[model samples]
Target chain A: MISSIFSQLFQTLLIVVLAPLLLGWVNQCRAWLQNKRGAGVLQPYRVLHKLFHKDAVLADNASSLFRTAPYIQFACMVLVASIVPMVATDLPFAAAADVIALVGLFALARLFAALAAMDIGTAFGSMGARREMLVASLAEPALLMILFTPALIAHSTSLTTIVEALAHREFVLYPSLAFAAVAFAMVALAENARIPVDNPATHLELTMIHEAMILEYSARHLALIEWASAIKLSNYSAIGIALFLPWGIASAGDWNAVPLALAVLFVKLLLGGAGLALLETLSAKLRIFRAPEFLGTAFLLAVLGMLMLEL
Target chain B: MATFTGQLINFLAALLLLIAFAMLSQRRILSLIHLFAWQGFILALSTTVVAYSTHQPHLYYSAFLTLVLKAFLLPWILHRLIIRLNIKWDVETMINVPTTMLVGIALVIFAFNLAAPISQLADTITRSTLGIAMASVLLSFLMMITRHKAVAQVVGFLAMENGLFFAATSATYGMPMVVELGIALDVLVGTFIFGIFFFQIRETFDSLDIKNLEKLKED
Candidate 1:
């Protein structure tokens, strides 16, 4: 009993600490793919440390929501980190929320972020807010459909139940899951502001979506939001791993398998991060107007995946 | 082995339907032709698998004919037609892509509903794939109706044929070898005639858009 509690605590702590490292690793891989020497893998930590030490600069008319939005976003991400079965499926926090609730948490964070973006009434901020909402509206349905594909197969909406069912099942190729994975990858790219949807590295005022909204933040508030974004990226990666590749995650009361699970999780993340970098390098950013078509295709693929399973 | 074969056939069928949707939404003429070729390749592959698993020796010949004619020869002809016509970058669509995609989805659902009863009555190892086969046919027909360029229409027509071939293979262990051979000859001759007609249309209208042919109608 005590070991379960200890493992839960350990998993939560690991998610929080490892998120920024994952971001740093993806960025480093991107740089390497572009044939540039990268800042070390610890660059995100250094940046976070620097931001936390500086004073926050706020707008003269900034509201309380503006000040607290960063914290809310950060907290939501942390809660999500705890809920997803990353290293182990038996974490206590996994019971607190099912897949739908987890999606709600993401929407909540996004709503807060968008509300805060429009609070100061800057032109760029409002524009960014509109674009972000547009992407979210299109992506959210597809996200739910993608989640439901596995839920239908496992006969449960709880992430832990789904993971356990899939992990213990006999080996068989599921074509519906193949469609769901493709749809999931597209939605993830769009939701995370990655290349082909919104370029994360670009700060061009006209083309930037995520950065334009947070343009006014600095110091501690900026640090928290950036950290939250990192956590969000890792959150998505963990969810993908949980759904499609849930084999190595340790089940509850299996203390002997925890070490091996951790190693497998690490290797999966490493390969996944590099694969993401390769994809980003190979594709160019779509024009802003084309984003709807991209997300629309994702939605269609997800629906087709569900239909394949049913019909 | 039998179960694996069934699963593999289902996977290939899903891919066939997906390629049909891709062709439906694609705007570039060259890309449309490429997707058509890919659809043919997958169709031939699925036919080969069905042949191997069901111990039908004639399907092996049908698959070989489909692979050579639909996958290689037809695409090669279309590529050369596009080069001679100088219309490689055409992107005109009578309906926007997203709306067309929504309509395509509806067609797929309708096809599945329509095929369910028919598939249930069939006693083949590949019966489950009949719905996907029908969906691809409807989607290809939708593509044919939505595009303005004559070349895209031709590609869509050929893709519709692909869906029909898939349907025949999946539903009935393929047509008799003689009928398959005759249809292959018909498609090859039809493609040649279509190529000649494209030139005639281009020479008469000075463009490849089928809408221009409206001038031939009397007011």
Candidate 2:
């Protein structure tokens, strides 16, 4: 029991610290792909460290919700990090690792951030919140359909069990999972505020969704929110790994296998980050009106996955 | 543990059905959204209790999702939408309240009948409540159909989803984490879209009455 607790604590710490590094890595990759010398891989960590030491600056109209958004966002991401099966499948709180709950964590963060954005009563903030919510609503159903495909095969909603089942190679060629995977990827892209949904790199108000909401925030508050966003990105990647690539996860009651599991996870994160950057680079931001159709396509694909499962 | 869980689920299912009835008979949009929130709270409480009783840790997350989305976030959004759209004073009904209530009762009966066969296949302790859940869903749908206001219709739609979520939890423990997360995202996004729709509706008709939308429907 003590060992499990220790491992969980270590894993949580690892994710919190490594999240910034991963973000920097993605940025560096994106820049390299664009044929420019990017910022150093440790740039995110440096920025975060600097931000934490600075005082927060808030707009005069900012309410309590705005003041509290950073903390809430940080807490939500931390909660999500704890639930994911990062280094080991048999996590201390593996039972709490329901996919739905993790989504709730994301929702919690999004809700606070969006609310904070609107609390300031800025046109851009409300607009961003509106757009964010629109994307979330459509993305969610498709995500649920995708999950049903996997749950049908694993016969349990527990992430640990699902990972173990997949690792054991219980079955092969889940056409439903394949479709769900594509839908999930689309939802993930939108949820994370990536390309074809909203550009992470752009600052234009008309095209901005995530950035516009954060425009009013400054200093430490901005840093925490940014750090949380990085963690969120990593968390989504980890979720993808847990669901689609469950091979390297160490089973519960296997403490001796953790190091190997950690090494495998690092490799997966690297590949996932690179792939995300590449996808972002290849895709142009979709028009605001086209987002629903993009998400609708995801929803259809997800439903297709569910229908395939019945076949 | 099983008995406690079974009783708790039964009580929650009953509460959900009652709320469904309330939503159906409600003439005020504000009250309907409040009742919908109360239903979400009950769903969250029951999910938590079931998670505790069965040692299904993931259900706790499900409960949290319910609390966040149904109880707090969605309601808050609706309230803001109501204020912004300036529809706080008017709530029009397509069907008379008493007639809507009677139709809701009939829908409930139909739901129970439809759910009976499916419930028989479920092995969970809350298996019997699946019928109640399905009934609530149908009644919520009936309420949606009977409401002439856009906001009320959205409330009914959300209520229907609440019933479906309850059924998912009670009949099958809970959905997979990914699906739950996905649905939660959908709900959050859906609310935003609906909020935008409410604005558009008001802009078009200068009122939230869905009767105006009928003009757009071809003969």
Candidate 3:
């Protein structure tokens, strides 16, 4: 029992620590693919540290609600990161919340952030708030529908149960899963404010959705939000891996299973980060109005995936 | 009968249904053609799979004919016809897309319910796929009704034939060899006639929109 606690703690620390590294790796890969000398992979960590040490600057009209939102969002992310079965299955904490609650966790974080954005009363912030809500309203349903396929396949909604079922099942290519994976990958990219949904690297003000919402944040508030976004990206990638590529994760209670699982996770993260960067570099961002159509396609694919499960 | 092959055939049948839905909702004429061709390709693949597993030789020839006639020849001919007609842009539908999709879903459920008893009567390895085959035919018919252009309707008509052909292979191991040959000739000749009809329609009305044909009926 004590070892389970220790492992859960380790998993929490691992998700928080690796989140920024994954973001930095994607950025570095994007730069390299664009034929430019890139910022090092440790750049996000340095930015986080610098922002933490700086003094926070608040608007004259800032509310207590605005001041409290960054922490709430950050806490939600940490809690979500802690519960998802990343390195080990059958973790004692996996039962605390299932996949649906995990989605609710994400939505809670977005709600806090959007509320904070509106609290500032700035034009850009409100516009960004509206856009973020629009994107989320479309994305959340697709996200739930995407989870339905694996949940149905595993016959459970708990993350660990689903992961264990996939790890133990005999291997065959599933059409429903293939369609869901594609849809989930698209949603993840959109939810993380990546390319073809919203460019993470663009500086043009009108082209921004995520960055606009954070225009008022400075110092550690910015640090926490930035870290939360990184955590969001890592959380999504881990969920995708747990569903579509379920091998090498340790479910046994043996103490010796830890090292191989960690090594496997590192390799998976590295490949996932590089592939995300490659895709972001290849695709152009769509017009804001067209985002609904993109998410609609994801929804269509998810619906088809569920229907395919029946056939 | 390996379970793996059974599952694989089921997966392909689902893909055929997916393409059928795509055809039903697709707005662009070019993409509708592509979806039709994809249906043909999946149909051919499923047939080949069934033939290999069931030790049927004639289904292989029908599969080849399907690949050439539906996948390659018809799409190529349709693409050429549209480019020559310059009517490749617009494909108006009778109803909005969401309504069409909802009705398509209802049709799929109905097909599943209808095919249940019939599938139990068949002894083929892919008998369970009968529902999907029927769903594809209904979806193609839906596409034909919703589409406004003559060319799009023609593609929909051809896609319905593809579904019917898929239904034959899955239910009874395909029709006789002579019947298969006759259908192939009929489809090829039909496409050519449709091509000539397209030119005459354009020449007579200066457009390919079938709504103009309503004027002839009224007069």
Candidate 4:
């Protein structure tokens, strides 16, 4: 039992620490693709370290919610890290590894941060909150449908079970999963505030969704929130990997199987990061009004996946 | 091991059904959101109970999700929406209170009948309560259809989700973590979008009455 706890703690720390590095890698790759020297891969770590030592300045009118947002965001991300099958699929807390619960963690964090944004009563904050919700509204159904496909296939909702089922080649050529995959990718892009949903790199008020909301946060609070955001991006990527790839994850009861699992996980993360950067580079941000249509399409695809499964 | 927990699960399931009915009959938007929160609370409790009984850790996460999203986050968003939209007054309902109550009863009966075969198939501890859960879902849907105010409809929508969550917990233990997370994200995002919709409705029609939106249907 003690060894399991230690392993779990170690895995959580690895995810939290490695999350920023992954973000930096994505940024650097994007820069290289754009033919610019770009910020170094270690830049995010430097920025985080620098911010952690600074004092946070709160707005006089800021409510308790604002003060609590950073902690809540960080805590929720940590919770998410704990649930995701990062280093090993045989996590001690794998029983808590329900996809719907994981989505709830993300939602809880988003809700808090959005509330914090609106608490200051700034126009940008409210606007950002509104847009963020818009993106989320359509994304939810699509996500549900995507998850339903896998649940139906495995006849169980547990990620570990599903991963094992897939790794063991329990089923083949599920057309439903393919449709769900596309739909999931769309929802992921929107949920993470990527291009075609909201540009993560831009600061323009008219176009920003995620950035505008955090414009008021600064110092350590900003750093934590930023780090949490990066972790979230990584988490979503890992989620995609677990559902789509599901190979090479070591099952529980084999301590010796961890190293191989870790290596495979690392390779998946790298490929996933590069793929995300390439997708972002190739896509343009959709207009705010058009976002619903994008997510609507995703929802329909997910439904189609479910229908196919039923058939 | 099984019978005692099964009985407790049934009791909690009944409480959840009671809350669903209360939410359906509520006319005030604020109170409806409050009831929705209570419903979420019950869901969380029942989920926790199920988790403990079944030794399923994921159910605990499911309970946590219900607590945070339904009990805390969504209600908070609804409260803010009401305040921002200045919609604290009594909301308009499409159907009369008595008629709605009668319809709700009919829905309950229909739910039991419809869920009978399915519930019989379920060997879970909370199998008998599956009918109540389906009834709650149908009743919440009815509430949505009978409410003429946008806020009321949103509350009903949320309550429906609560019923679905209860079904998952009681009948099947809980959904996958990925699916739960996805639903939680969806609900949070849905609430925010609905909040914005409330604002837009007020701005466009100068009232919170969703009947005004019907004008678009005619056009």
Q: What is the TM-score of chain A alone in each candidate?
A: 0.98, 0.96, 0.98, 0.96
DockQ-wise, the better of 3 and 4 is 3
Q: Give lDDT tens digits, candidate 2, residues A1-110.
A: 88778778887788888999999999999999899899989999899888888887888878898988999999999888877787787576767668777677788889
| Residue B3, candidate 1: C-alpha displacement in angstroms | 0.7
lDDT of 4 by residue, B1-219 (tens): 566666666656655665776676576788888888888888898888888987999888888888888899889888887887776578677776645665766677677777788877887777777777887899899988987888888888988888888777767887899999998999899988888887887888888787787675535
Best by TM-score: 1
TM per model?
Answer: 0.98, 0.59, 0.95, 0.59
Question: For residues A187-236, could you state the per-residue lDDT of candidate 1 as single tens digits?
Answer: 99999999998999889988999998999899999999999999999999
lDDT of 2 at A58: 83
Candidate 3: residue A197 Cα off by (Å): 1.4
Where does model 1 exceed 4 Å of error? Answer: B216-219
Write down the worst ten-residue block by lDDT for model 4 chain A. A302-311
How do the residues A97-165 of candidate 4 rate in per-residue lDDT, one tens digit apiece? 587887778888989988999999999999999888888877886787798788788887877777777
lDDT tens digits by residue: candidate 3, A1-311: 88888888888889999899999999999999999899899999999999999999999999998999999999999998887888888478778899999999999999999999999899989998899999999999999999999999999999889998998878876888988998999899889999988988776778899988999999999999999999999999889999988888888475687799889999999999999989988899999988887887788778778776765
Winner by DockQ: 1
Q: Which stretches of candidate 4 lie above 4 Å from their native place?
A: B1-219
What is the C-alpha local distance difference test score of candidate 1? 0.92
Model 1 root mean square deviation, Cα atoms: 1.3
List the candidate 3 regions with Cα displacement exceeding 4 Å: B88-90, B94-103, B217-219
The TM-score measured for candidate 3 stands at 0.95
B163 Cα displacement, candidate 2 (Å): 37
- Compared with the true structure, all predictions reach lDDT values of 0.92, 0.81, 0.89, 0.81
